[model samples]
Every structure is written in C-alpha cells, then in structure tokens.
Target: MEMTSRTKKFTYYRRKATNVIMLSSSFFSAIITIIPLFLVFYYTVREGLRYLNIDFFTKLPTPIGEPGGGMVNAIVGTLILIGIGGGIGIPVGMLSGIYLSEFGKNKFGTLVRFLADVLSGIPSIVVGVVAYTLVVLPMKHFSALAGGVALAILMIPTITRTTEEMINLVPHSYREAALALGIPKWKTILFIVLKTAWKGIATGVLLGLARAAGETAPLLFTALGNRFWSTNIFRPIASLTVFIYEYSKAPFKDWNEQAWTAALVLIMLISIVSLVFRLITRSKY
Candidate 1:
C-alpha cells in the first residue's frame, strides 16, 4: 500500500512539474517577444522627442545640412499611397477570399491558394521590380500610383488569407438557417456569413494597411522620392519610409535626426493602427 501511494504521489508531482514548466515557457516567450518592442519605442522616443513639433508636421524636407525641415511631404505621400492601395486592395482581396472559401474546393482554388502563398513569400523588392517594369517603366517615370500598385500586391495576400480564415470560422448552421428561410446561397453568404466575420475581416484589412505603410523596398523604385511637395500621382512622391532611408544614408546630422524622427512617426502610426484594429475586433460590431 505504501509503494502504491508513493507511485501516485510521484505521478502527481510529475504532472505538476510539467504544468509549471509549460506555464513558465509561455510567460518567457511572451516577454521575449515584447522586449524588442519596448526597446524600439524607448530609443525612438528618446531620439525623436527633440524634433517633435507643429513645424515638423508643416514644413518641407530641407537640404542635407539644413535645419527646421520636416516630413510634411512624406506624410502626405504616405496617406495618398495608403488610400489608393487600400481602395484597390480591399475589394479584390475580399472577393478573392470569398471565392477561395466559397468555391475553392476545385483545382482552380488550389492553384490560387498556392499562388497567394508564393506571392506572400516573394521579397518586397521583387514586387517593386515588377511594379517598376509594369507601371513606372511603362509610364517613363516613378509615381505614387506605381507605388500604390506595389503596396496593393503586398496587401492582397494578407487580406485574402485572413478573410478566408475568418469566413471559414463561421458556423455552417448559419448558412443552413438562411437556406431554410428561403435565402439563396449567394445572398446568405453575402449577408449572414460576411456579417458574422466582419470584425475579423476589418482586422485583416487594418493589418494589411499597417504592413503596407512601413514598406520601403517596394516603394524604393516605384514612388522614389520627391524633393518638394507633389500632388501629382504621376510624379515621384515622398514617403516616410523613403524619407527615412534617404536621410539616414547621408552623413549630415540634421538629416539623420529627421530620419530618426520619421522612423518614430511611422512606428507610432503603425502602433495606433494596430491598437485600433485590436479594439475593433474585440468589439461586438
């Protein structure tokens, strides 16, 4: 009886130890992931605080050694790129996702899925090259429109995958219920399935936008960069990432400071967008 009791005690201790180890590992993993974010935020704010001002948002980028310049042009260009990219990306992504989830049981669906996976893995620089060839080269000039196309390509795969996953999570019972109520399959999917998965879809779209906003390589050859403010989509436009890249390459102190400031701004913008997406996904709507 003592031996049996000892065996039971040993088994209990083993299980307890396993649970403790698993919990500790998970906690450590989370901390590891968060450490880089904390460091980035700390350093960015430390370096950028001095340059944070209303003038920073209103003035144009100056010559390499000049002071008092800002990223107003870059900010505007980033906004325009995001707007155009999102406008093209969202509809195409959503429809492709719907097709993948609703009608993708065949060979065609498999091919599309494979293509999306391949596209996602392709380097951003490659997308830029393709865009340059198809858009910028064809037009004989770098433009915000070409940059938008490059970003749209990056956005599409992310949006498509997330949307498909979200729609798949909707219960089959919802579809059956709609069908029993005399709703057609297409109508049911349009109203019921999409409504149920709206939050997840929005989350994906926001994440895609965040990803696109920080892309530098894709915009490097596509949008290039403008020295002055440009409203023309057909001409090279300044972007925060491109601004940071260009300024950081120079040896000038003022330009370097501006680069750090631009980096900080981009980080903040992405963080805000991600936080908003999280909040939206958590809400009932």
Candidate 2:
C-alpha cells in the first residue's frame, strides 16, 4: 500500500511539473509573437512618417525622383482589385462551404475537399503564372481584372475551409429546432444555421481579404502596376503590393522611401480590417 501511494504521488507531481512547463513555454511563445508586431509597427511608422503627407494620399505616382508623387493610384487599385476578388470569391466559397458542411458526406464532396486541400498548398506564384497564361496572355495585357481573378483563387480555399468549419460548429439542435417548425432544410440552413454562424463567416471573409491584400507575386504579372491614376478595370493598375515590389527594386532613394511607406500602408490597412472583424465577431452585433 505504501508503494502504491508513493507511485501515485510521483505521477501527480510529474504531471503538475509538466503542465507548468507547458504553460510557461506557451506564455513565452505568445510574447515572442507579439514583440515582433510591436517592433514592426514602431519601425515602419518611424521610417515612413517623413514621407506621409496630404499629397501622399491624394496625388498620383510620378518619375522616380519626383518630390510630391503619392500612392493614390496604388491605393485605389488595391481597393478595386480586392473588391472585385471579394465579390467573386465570397459567394462561390460560401456555397461550396455550405455544400461541404450540409451535404458533403458523399464521394464528390470528398473529392472537392481533397482538391481544396491541394489548391491551398499550391504556391501563390504558380497561381500568378496560371493567371498570366490563361487571362493576361489571351487578353494581351495585364489588367486589374486579371489580378482580381488571381486573388479570388487564393481567397476561395481559405473562405471555403473557414466557412465549412464555422457552419459545422453550428449546433445540431438549432437545425433540428428549425426543422421541427416545418421549415425546409434549405430554409433552415439559410435562416437559422447561417444566422448563428454569421460572425464566424464574416471573420473568415476578413481573413481571406487580409491574405489576398498582402499578395505580391500573383499581382506581379497580372496587374503589372501603373504610374498614373486609373479607374478602368480593363487596364493595368497600380497596387500597394506591386508598387512596393517595383520601388524596392529601384536604385533611387526616394523610390525606396515610397516603398517603405507603401508597405506601412498595407500593413496598417490589414491590421485595421482584422481588428474590426474581431470586434464585430466579439460583440453582440
């Protein structure tokens, strides 16, 4: 009896120590992750503040050494491309997610799930190449439309996965309750299940947008940056990512400063969007 008591005490003490170690490791990892974000914001704001001006938000890009040239064109182009991508991707992704969660126990659903997994793993540059060949080459020009399409491809898998998981998390009781009211399966899903999961779905869409916004490789051969202001979806457009890429490669100090400023803008935009989404999800709204 004494031996058995000692064995139990030893196991309990070991488990307690292990849990303490695990908790400390997790705390340190979280601190490490947060430190980089703070450092990045500090550095970006410190370096980029000199270039930030009213003109920087209003005027268009100009010659490399031009003093007053701004990121207005790139900002507009980024918005347009992301808007188009979201418009195309969200509906398709939501539908696919619904199908996967609601009716995807069969062979075809399994195939789709497998394909989504595979597509998610494919590199962004590969998608850009495919977009170039299929959309840009055939059209004989890089345009905002092509970039939007490439970004849409990247957004779809993320949306689908998140939507599927969120929808699945909706309580079975909710669906049953709706059905007991003589509601059809489609109506139940549309009215009850989706309503309950709306916040999660919005979070997924925001995440997808954040991912799409930072992409540079796919936009390289697709949008192919413009120096002047343009609103035409059919023409090449300047985006912050593309502008950052092109400027960072130039041999001019002014252009490099603009690149850093553009990068800061992109980071800030994504962070705001993410925080807004988190707030929306967390609130009763």
Candidate 3:
C-alpha cells in the first residue's frame, strides 16, 4: 500500500512538471512571435508619420526634384486593380470549390486537387511571367488587365481551398435534412451549405486580397507602373506597392520619407479591407 501511494505521488508530480513546462514554452513562443510584429508596426508609424499629410491623399505624385506630392493616383489604381481581380477570381474560385467539395471524390478530382496545391506553391514572379506572356504579349503592352489576371491567378488557389474546407465543415446531416424536405440538391447547396459557410469563405477571400494588394513582382511584369492618372483597364496603372518600391530607392529625402508613408498607408488599406469584409460577413443572427 505504501509503495502504491508513492507511485501515485510520483506520477502526479511528473504530470504537474510537464504541464508547467509546456505552459512556459507556449508563453515564451507567443511573446517571440508578437514582438517582431509590434516592432515593425511601431517603426512604420514612427517613420511614416513624418510625411503623412492631407496632400499625400489628395494630390498627384510630383516630378523628381519637386518638393511635395501625393499618391492619390496609386491609391485609386490599387482599388481598381483589386476590383478587377475580385470580379474574375471570386466566381471561378467559388465554383471550383463547390465542385471540389461536392463531386471531387474521384481520380479526376484528385488530379485537380494536386494541381491546386502545385499552383499555390508556384512563385508570384512565375505567375507574373505567365500573365505577361498570356495577356501582355498578346495585347502588345503591359496593362491593368494583365495585372488583374496575375492577381486573380494568385487568389484562386487560396480561395478555392478555403472554400472547399469551409463547405466540407458543414454537417452531412444538414444536407440530408434539406434533401428530406424534397429540396433539390442544387438549391440545397446554394442556399443552405453556402449560406452556412459564407463567413469562412469570406476570410479566405480577404487573405487573397491582402496578398494580391502587397505583390510588386507581378505588377511590375504586367501593369508596368504608370506615372499619370488613368483608369483604363487596358492601360498601364500605378499601385501602392510599386510606388513604395520606386520611392524607397530614390536619391531624394522627400521621396524616401514618402516611401515610409506609403508603407503605412498600405497597411491601413489592408486593415480597412479586413474590416469591411468582417462587417459584411457578420452573422445575421
């Protein structure tokens, strides 16, 4: 009996020690992860605030050697590019996702899944090269359309996989219930499964948007960066990422400061996108 009691005490103490060690590890791991993010944000705000002003939002970028300018054109162009990307990406991604979740259990589906995973791993620069060949070359010029196409390709795999996972999370019982009510399979999927998983799908879309918004390589090959304001989808366009890249490398102090401000603005734009999507996707209940 004494031996058994000592054994029990030994086991208890060991478990307690393991738990404490794990908890400490997790605490330190989280602190390490968050510290870098905090430092980047703090530094960005410190440098960016020096040049941030009303003119930065309302006026056009000035010529080299000029004193002051804003990135209003780049801001507008970024929005338009995102809009174009979303228009092309959302429908194709959602449909592919639905098909994969519902009917992708066979060998063909396996092939498609493999392809998506491969596509997701491809470098953005490679996608830009492909887009340049497919759209820019045929059109005989770099254009916003080519950039939009590049962004859409980058967005597809993320949106498609996120959608498939979200849809699969819906209980099979929900589908059974809908079918038992004499509902058509198409209608049931469209109204029931889709509505239930919309929030998760929206998150995937937001992630894709954020990634596309920050991409410079793809836009460099496809859009080519414009100096003047132009909204034509067939024309080269400016964007925040390209502006930041160019300004950060300039010899002028003012342009370098504007780079910091542009970086901060890009962060703000991404945050705003996240917020708008969150509100739109909020639970109706």
Candidate 4:
C-alpha cells in the first residue's frame, strides 16, 4: 500500500512539473512573437517624432535642394485614392458576398469563392501589373485612376470573404422568422439579415481600406507619383506610400526625415479612419 501511494505521489508531481514547463514555454513564445511588433512601433515613433509638425500636414513638397516642405499633396492624394478605391470596391464586394452567403450553394458560387481565394493570394505587385495593362497602357499614361483600380482590386477579395462570413453568421432562425412573416427574400436580406451583420461588414471594409492605404508597389506602376498637388483622376497624384518610398531612398537628410514623418502620419491616418468608422457604426443597443 505504501509503495502504491509513493508511485501515485511521484506521478502527480511529475505531471505538475510538466504542466508548468509547458505553460512557461507558451508564455515565452507569446512574448517572442510580440516583441518585434512593439519594437517597430517604438522605433517608428522615436524616429518620426523629430520631424512631425503642422507644416508637414499643410505645406507642399519644396524643391529638391530646399529644406522646408510638407507632404500636403500626398496626404490629400492618399484620401482621394482611398475614396476612389472604396467607391468601386465596396458595392461589388458586398453584393458578391451577399450572393455567396444567401444563394451560393452551387458550382458557380464555388467557382467564385475559389477565384476570390486565389486573387487574395496573388502578389500585390502582380495586381499592379494587371492594372497597368488594363488602365495605364490603354490610357497611354499612369494616372490616379489606374492606382485606384489596383487598390480596388486588392480590396475586393478581402471584403468579399469577410462579408460572406459575417452574413453567414446571422442565424438561420432569424431568416426563417422573417420569411414566415411574409417578407420578401430581398427585404429580409437587406433589412433583417444585413442589419445584424453590419458591424462585422464595417470591420471588413475598414481592414480592406487599411491594407490599401499602405500599398506602394501598385502606385509605382499605375499612379506613377506626382510631386505637386493635383486631384484630377486622370493625372498622376502624390500618395504617402509612394512619397515615403521615393523620399526614403533619396540621399537628402531632410527628405529622409520627411519619409519617417510620412510613415508616422500614415499609421495615424489608419487609426483615425478606423476610430471614425467605428463611431459612425456604433451599435444602438
């Protein structure tokens, strides 16, 4: 009896030790994963803070040799590009998602889902190339429109998948209840189902916009970057991403500092966009 008791005690302690070791390892792994993100945020703020000022938000880029300039044009252009991209992408993506969620239990729907997955996996630069061929080559010049098209394409797959998943999460019981009330299928989807899932759909839209905001490669081939202020969709436009890419590579100290400032501003812009949208879409209940 003593021998059996000793064996049981030993086994219990061994299991306890093993559990502690595993828990420690998991905690360590999480720390390792988070460290890099924290470091990047730290460094970006540290380096960018030196040059951030009101002028950076309000003035235009000065001549190359001059020291004082701002990225006003780039900021404005970025907003315009996002607006254009959203205008094209959001409706298409939301409609496609609705169709897939509501009536996509067939081969055609399967094909579309497959295509969206594949498109999501394709390189952003390749999408840039495609946009170039479709818009830039035909127009015979790079323009903000071409860049917007590329961003819209990139936004579509993510928005579509997110919308489908969010809508699907709406309970079947809710749909059935609405249908039994003699509501039309379209009305049920539009008013009953979609309303329930609007917050999730908004999150997805914001995510797509965030991803599109930082893209530099597509703008390289399509928008082609302007140095001055211009909002004409058919003309080249400055954007923060392209501005950062170009200035960061330049030998000038002032331009490099500006690049850091732009990076910081870009992050801030995304945060503001998210917060504003969240407030606008705040749940009433």
**What is each predicted model's overall lDDT from 0 to 1?**
0.91, 0.91, 0.92, 0.94
Stretches of model 1 off by over 4 angstroms after superposition: 1-34
Per-residue C-alpha lDDT of model 2 across residues 100-181, encoded as one tens digit per residue: 9999979999999889889999999999998888889899999999999999999999999889999999999999989999
How far residue 186's Cα lies from its native spot in candidate 1, in Å, is 1.8
Best of the candidates, TM-score: 4
Model 3 per-residue lDDT tens digits across residues 13-42: 999999999999999999999999999999
For each of the candidates, the C-alpha root-mean-square deviation to the true structure, in angstroms, is 3.7, 4.0, 3.5, 2.3
Model 4 lDDT per residue over 1-285, tens place: 999999999999999999999999999999999999999889879888988999999999999898887999999999999989999999999999999999997999999999999999999999999999999999999999999999999999999999999999999999999999999999999999999999999999999999999999999989989989899999999999999999999999989988989999999999999999888888454
Which runs of model 4 end up more than 4 angstroms from their true locations?
A: 1-22
Error of 3 at 141 (Å): 0.9
User: Residue 185 of model 2: what lDDT?
Assistant: 100
Can you write out model 1's per-residue Cα lDDT over 1-285, one digit (the tens) per residue? 999999999999999999999999999999999999999889889998778888879999777556787889999999899888899999999999999999997999999988988889999999999999989987998999999999999999999988998999999999999999999999999999999999889989998999999999999999998889997989999999998898889888878888889998998888987897787678754
Write down the TM-score for model 2: 0.87
Instruction: Tell me each candidate's TM-score.
Output: 0.87, 0.87, 0.89, 0.92
Kindly give the number of clashing pairs for every candidate.
0, 0, 0, 0
In lDDT terms, which candidate is top?
4
Assess candidate 3 and give its TM-score to the true structure. Answer: 0.89
